[model samples]
Target: MANIVIIGGGPAGYESAYVADSLGASVTLIDYDAPGGACVHYDCVPSKAFIASSEVVSNTRHADDLGIRMPSPDEITVDAPQVYNRVKELARAQLADVTAGLAKTKVTVVRGRGRLLATEEHGSHPVEITPEGEPAYTVEADVVLLATGASPRVLPGAEPDGERILNWRQVYDLPELPSKLIIIGSGVTGAEFANAYTEMGVEVTLIASRDRVLPHEDGDAARLLEDSFTRRGMTILTHGRAKTVQNTGDGVRVELADGRVIEGSHCLMTVGSVPNTTDLGIEEAGVEVDDGGFIKVDRVSRTSVSGVYAAGDVTGVLMLASVAAMQGRIAMWHALGEAVAPLQLKTVSSNIFTHPEIATVGIGEKTIDDRDMDVRSVTMPLRTNARAKMAELDDGFVKLYARPTTGVVIGGVVVAPHASELIMPITLAVRQRLTVQQIASTFTIYPSISGSISEAARRLIEHDDLD
Candidate 1:
């Protein structure tokens, strides 16, 4: 059996471990934390748990709108401590589940920080593992996969104090919810937290450098979310760039580049993320990295050095957990001499978890316009759907893009509650290169938000027939 050693226990590492072991490879996984890495311990899992709690709070507040007469809706309040506890509990449970799954596999789990040692003359790679408060040891492997994930980017003069001024990872440690929360950056992380806190009854101020939030996402989706945030009393400061943040012992103050100062009970910074590639012996291993310190890898996840592969946020390819897992699997498949296809980034689907979620797959409208491709597009508003009107949701739409002549579905965007779930069929259509007629002919439950996706595809088919 081939010997494999993977560094970093995130989705990339563990998922690859499973694949390698199942493929008759002896795998050793070195992880800094639990098997799930930062996603489970700090980011994705815990944050989603917090969002779920906030969504409940939001739904209860709007119960009257749904015609559910309640005795005292105003009396509903979020227990901040309880919410944090629950988030932590959910993260722990996920970690336990991941650890248990690894135990069932033959892959050996090592707790430590791992770095690449100089390649041996026999062509076997050696990985030096340094366990915290323990002596360092080296493990030789026929193949080595680097999956060290990324960390939250910290701005100059705005370091997280873990008290008042905070980063996304530090929010769960908050003792009490702030009366007013100031979120810096209007990207996915920033928008998600701003929406969650606002729903949880905290007055939120979102600072966006762009004209609208989620500048990289679909324009219509961003506009709908921005409007929803404003209607819910969340203050959005567009075209505002935060220069510095100061924790004044009690509250936090943020200074903008355009000579503006904003104060709030707490400040959360969601600027971006930096790949955790420092001191991993990239130069020693002769691995090439980009100017931003991200390891340069091709679609097959091969680094500059042969037998040494990289995946996940370390490779800076999309940075989603699902993408990380796929990259990891591809690397193992290639290394183990299994048939593998290169990663197709265009077919990858993504979602922004906001109040009304925005999910997208395949090509975007901007890409079509930039390339001036011959594409036909159609949009169906959720307000026209029977289920949406019955649920009192009027703020989202399903958009489909197809080839003008062949009518094959190339891309789609959905903005609505549970858009993540609703985008699956559209994602399948894009991935399989299914035609508009195929999606239109597929039966979607009547009165469902997903029905809008089919309706949009039907409109595209009709447009194609007209031509």
Candidate 2:
């Protein structure tokens, strides 16, 4: 049995540790925090729970339009703390389950700061870990999996104090709701919180450096989201980069590059992430890292230094929690000489948890823009469908792209309420390379949002009428 040492107890590290332990390997998992990682304790579960409360508020407000009356007097309002408490409760429950699973697998959890100790005088080559306040655990392991995750990147001028100014993870701590919230950097995380908070009755102003929100998403989809958010009283300022963020006596002030300034009760920055790869003695171990401080790893997640591997946000792989988990699993399998497939980024699916959500997978329009592939596509509006009419949803659609010559599905985009769930069928098609004809033939409930999936594929199959 080989000894496995994993650093960072986030989704990536804990998942891999459990897998390694199940495979009969002796494992030691080290994390400064609890076993659930940032995703559980701060990022994923907590954020989604807060978003769920926002969903409730939105649904309550829209109930009358759906002919479903809520008889609560004086109109329903937000309870930020209770909502936040609910988020914490859910996170705790999920963390409990995850920790329970790790226990069952017999994975040893070490709580402390873990640093690599050099075996040689030059401080080069294989590693021995020096844990905080404990004996120097000289781990002579068959393999060391580096699953250390990342943290929210703080732009130089916009530092967060976790009070009036904060990042995504710190928002839940506010005792009360901000009367006005100014959100800078309208990327995926930024857009998501903006939408959720606005729905929960916070006046939100979104500041973006680009021309549109979610600049990384499909152009049309981004435009649609901008329109939708605007309709919901969200003030969007594209091309307005935040130059300086300062706390005023009443609230926070953001001076933009364009000379205009805005103020709000709180400023939340969601610029992006920085990989947590430094100070782990990776460089001393001869492992290569990119200029951006992300560890360099091969398709199989192997680093330049043998017996050392890295995965997840630290490697700068796709930053999704799911992708991080998969990379961690693949790393363990490879290091243990089990069956493994080289990482294929193209097939991974990710979703934005915005109202009228966006989810996608496989070959994208960006990749196909310059190629000579025989691609055909169809965009079918949800408003035109039976289910959408029943639900009274004004925004969303199913867009599918396929290889015309081979009839194989290549890419797809779904924009709908619960679009995340609806995109599963399209994801399966693209991953399996199933043709538009096959997707069209699949059965779907007539009064369901997923019917748009088949309808969009059918439209692509009959392209002559589209023009």
Candidate 3:
């Protein structure tokens, strides 16, 4: 059996460990934290738990609109402490579940920080492991997979003190919801927290360096989200760039480059992330990294050096946990000499978990326009959908793209409540190369938001037929 050493316990690490063990390899998984990595412990799981609570609060506040009148909808308030407690509980439970699952496997889990020692002459690599409060040791491996994840990028002047000024991870430690929150960087992380907190009754001010929030997402979806945020009483300052942030003992103050000062009870910096590859000895091991310090790997997850592979956020492919897991599995399959296909980024589906979630798959409008691809597209508004009307959700849409000549489904975008759930069929269609006619012919339940997907597909077919 090949001896494999996988570093980083996040989605990429643990998922690959399972794959390597299943392939009858001796796998040793090393991580400084628990099995689930930052996604489970700090970023994705905890934040989504909080968002779920905020959604409940929002539903209660809007109960009267649905004719489910409560005694006092206006007085509905979020129990911040209870909500945070549940978030922590959920994260811990998930971590325990992952640990239990891994226990059944032959994979050896180690709690330590791992770095590549050097590439040996005998085609074996040595990894130096340093466990917390313990001495350092070395493990020899036939193959080394680097799944070390990324960390939140901190600004020079806006360092997170874990009190008034915070990063995405530090918000969980907050004692209570801030009275007023100022969010810097209007990217996905910034927009999500701003949306959740605004729904939870905190005054939210979002600072965007670009012309609009979610500058990287679908333009139509971003505009609709911005409108929804505005309706929910959130302040959006477009073209506003944070020069510096100062925590004034009790609150935080932000100075904008355009000569504006904003003050809030708390500040969240959602600038970006940096890969955790600095101290991993990638340089010493002859693993190549990009200009941004991210590991440079082929689609098969193979690094520059033979017998060395990289995956997940460290590879800088897609930062989503699902992508990380996929990359990790690919790395193991390739290493174990199993039948494996190169990672197809075009078929990857991703979701932004906002109030009205944005889910997308395959080719997008920007790519189509940039490359001048010959494609037909259709957009179906949710306002016209029966289920959306029943649910009193009026602000979202479904868009489908297809080849004008062959009618094959190339990509899709869904903007609605639980769009993440609705994007699966579209993702399947994209991955399977199903045509628009096939999607239109698929059975869909009436009075459902998913019907909009088929409707959009049907419209694409009609347009193609006309052409």
Candidate 4:
């Protein structure tokens, strides 16, 4: 049996450790925190927990409009501390469940910071981790999986003081929500927080360097998001270049490159992320890192080093929780010399947790623009869908892009309630390259949100308009 040492407790490390342990490999999972990794402990789970509460509060405010009467409090109250506690409780419980399962396997979860040390005078290097207690325990194994996640990007001038200006990860501890929030970046994370907080009654201003929100998404989808955000009272400044953020006595003032200034109670720097690769001894271990320090990996998740492998955000390939999990699994199979499939991002589904949440898969306008592929798209507004009208939701639609000749779907987008769920069928179709006729033929529930998906596909078949 091969002994596998998985570093970092993030999704990539924990998932691969679980997989390797199940495959009868002795696994040692090393990290400073518990097994749930960043996604569960700090990122995905906890944030979603907060979002759930905020969503409830916002939806309740709109209950009467839904023909449902909600009990009205003279002055609605928000117990932020209690809400935060619940978020932590949910995150902790989920982590405990994952840790419990690792017990039966020969998987050891060690708490420490690991480094790759020079091997003995005769062999390859081994991972050296300094345990957090007296007389640290050192465990060495043959295979090493690197899943150290990424950290929120802190710009040169705009460092997260953790007070006035903060990263998305630090917002969970905020006792009082921002009265007016200025999110400095119109990326996925930026838009998500803007939408979520705005729904929770925060006055949100989305500052973007690009012309519109979600510049990387389909043009129609981007336009829709921009329109929706504007309708929701979001102050969107296109071509906005935030220079410096100064903490004012009352709030914070952001100086733009164009001499324009804006102020807000709080600022979220959703700029980007930097892979956590420094000081891990990655370079010393012979692993090739990109100029930006992200570990260089192939489609199969193999780094330059043979015995060592890297996955997830560290690889810098589409930093999503789902992508991280898949990379982890692929790294293990390839390392173990078992059957493994190369990473196929063509089918990877992504979602922006915004107000009219945008979920997409396969390729989009960005792909078409860069690759210069001749594809046809059919964009149908949800305003025309009976289900959307009945639900009183007029803010989203389904768009499908296909290869005109073969009628095979190459990409698609969905925006609406449960858009994350609604986009799955389109993602599957794109991944499998299913024909527009195939999607149109599928039985869709009457007056359902997903019916728009069928409508979009059918339109593509009928129009034959390739733009």
What lDDT does each candidate get?
0.91, 0.84, 0.91, 0.83
lDDT of 1 at 247: 91
Ranked by lDDT, top first: 3, 1, 2, 4
Query: What lDDT score goes with residue 253 in model 1?
Result: 92
- In model 2, the runs with Cα more than 4 Å from the true position are 71-74, 118-135, 370-373, 464-467
lDDT (C-alpha) at residue 349 in model 2 = 79
Which of the predicted structures, 1 or 4, would earn the higher TM-score when compared with the native? 1
Residue-level lDDT tens digits of model 2 in 35-89 = 8888999999999888888887887878887899895523678888898889999
164-274: candidate 3 lDDT, tens digit per residue: 999998887887899999999998999889999998889999999999999988898999999999999999999998889999999999999998999999999999999
lDDT of 2: 0.84
Pairs of residues at least 3 apart in sequence or in different chains that clash in candidate 1: none
What C-alpha RMSD separates each model from the true structure? Answer: 1.2, 2.4, 1.1, 2.4
Q: Which regions of candidate 4 fall more than 4 Å away from where they truly are?
A: 69-77, 119-123, 136-139, 464-467
Better of 1 and 4 by lDDT: 1
lDDT of 4 by residue, 275-329 (tens): 8877788767778888888999999888887778888888899998888889999
For each candidate, give its TM-score against the true structure: 0.98, 0.95, 0.98, 0.94
lDDT: worst 10-residue window of model 1: 458-467
- How much lDDT does candidate 1 score? 0.91
